[model samples]
Target: MKKLFSFLLLAFMVVNLAHAQQDPQALKILNQMSQKYKSMNAFKATFTQTLENPSAKVKETMQGDILVSGPKYRLAVSGQEIINDGKLMWTYLKDVNEVTITENDAEAESMSPSKIFDMYKKGYKYALAGTEKQGAETVDVIELAPEDRSNPIFKVRLYISQKDKTLKSWQMFRNNGNRYTYSINNFVANPTLASDTFSFNKAKYKGVSVVDLR
Candidate 1:
């Protein structure tokens, strides 16, 4: 489940440079959203994730929380906690009472939580899909298609709040007939986080097993 969550989250860390035929309106909205995120020093958010596979008739929902500060982040979901302090990553699995440590490689094309802020600068084609009313607020919808047809993901959709320029939800459509959705329920911007918030403390988990892959 941890690997699945990570894989799904990383799918959002994809984008491509703008093209001549790119939609200006979509780019404008994306830029605004990116700028708003970049201005934040630290943030915490509670979110819910849903995975549905219509062909297999499988559906599951999970709740999670994330704390991010620059390139460092801590993600907690479904009995697993992943912590990254820019250069190192620690994944603690509660079910097994084990923690795996590894080096953080940004060039690996894998997803990092920080990538969510500026993913629009990567290999994708995007356009403003439409607008909708969500409760009392209006939302701007954007759809993204990967430039590489071989990618497992077929499409990515983003729902941004027009009033606050914040992301409300995102969904990914996979070629395997599976869809993953993430909805932000609560967000606190510029939160005061401790210096060691992204670091893993081995002492706290007394008898936990440690596997260092770095």
Candidate 2:
């Protein structure tokens, strides 16, 4: 479950990257994000995730909130949660009551960056999908391709609201020949969130076993 959510999160990183200076007007607007995004070190947002399979069913709506600081962060969903402290990746499933801790040194986990700028430099293709005004602010719908996003995971797309350059929605393509959809319902940036909230307590689930994958 988390593995898929992580991928969905990674896809967002790709869309949030700064726009190339193809237009002076857009460049100036993109530059302004520098100041606005500083307070974005932390965000608390409710996510509605839908994972699909070919099992004659539809997507499952898993509600959750994510607290992130790039590689050092955590996401709580349903009754389970996943955490990363820049050193470890912990996944705890409340239903099964199992906790799996692993080293954070994974190719996928390393993609964690404070901003989208990191992803563009890592070889991602980006294009603009015109623009629309959300309320009083405008948004640029940008789409990304890894230039080699054929992993059967799915084709990824992103909506970057021009208002804040923040991602608004995302979708994933699964190899099961199914489509998994995910969206951010609301967001609160750099709110007064607690620090320990991102930590995992092994003792909290004494009945569950700890499986270290690293």
Top-lDDT structure, candidate number: 1
Question: Per-prediction TM-score, please?
Answer: 0.87, 0.70
lDDT of each: 0.84, 0.62
- Which residue pairs collide, candidate 2? 139-162, 153-173, 154-173
Question: How good is model 1 by TM-score?
Answer: 0.87
In the range 29-113, model 1's lDDT, one tens digit per residue, is 9999988888999889999999999669999999999998888899999999999988999999999999999999885524466
Error of 2 at 83 (Å): 0.4
Flag clash pairs in model 1. 15-122, 15-123, 16-122, 16-123, 16-124
| lDDT tens digits, residue span 1-214, model 2 | 9878986895675444323333344344444543455546676678787877646576577887777664466778788888888777788988888899888775675234333423433445555546776465566655445544554443455545665667665565555657656577888887775657666776667888789888
Candidate 1 stretches with Cα past 4 Å from truth are 1-20, 107-110
| Model 1 global lDDT (CA atoms, 0 to 1) | 0.84
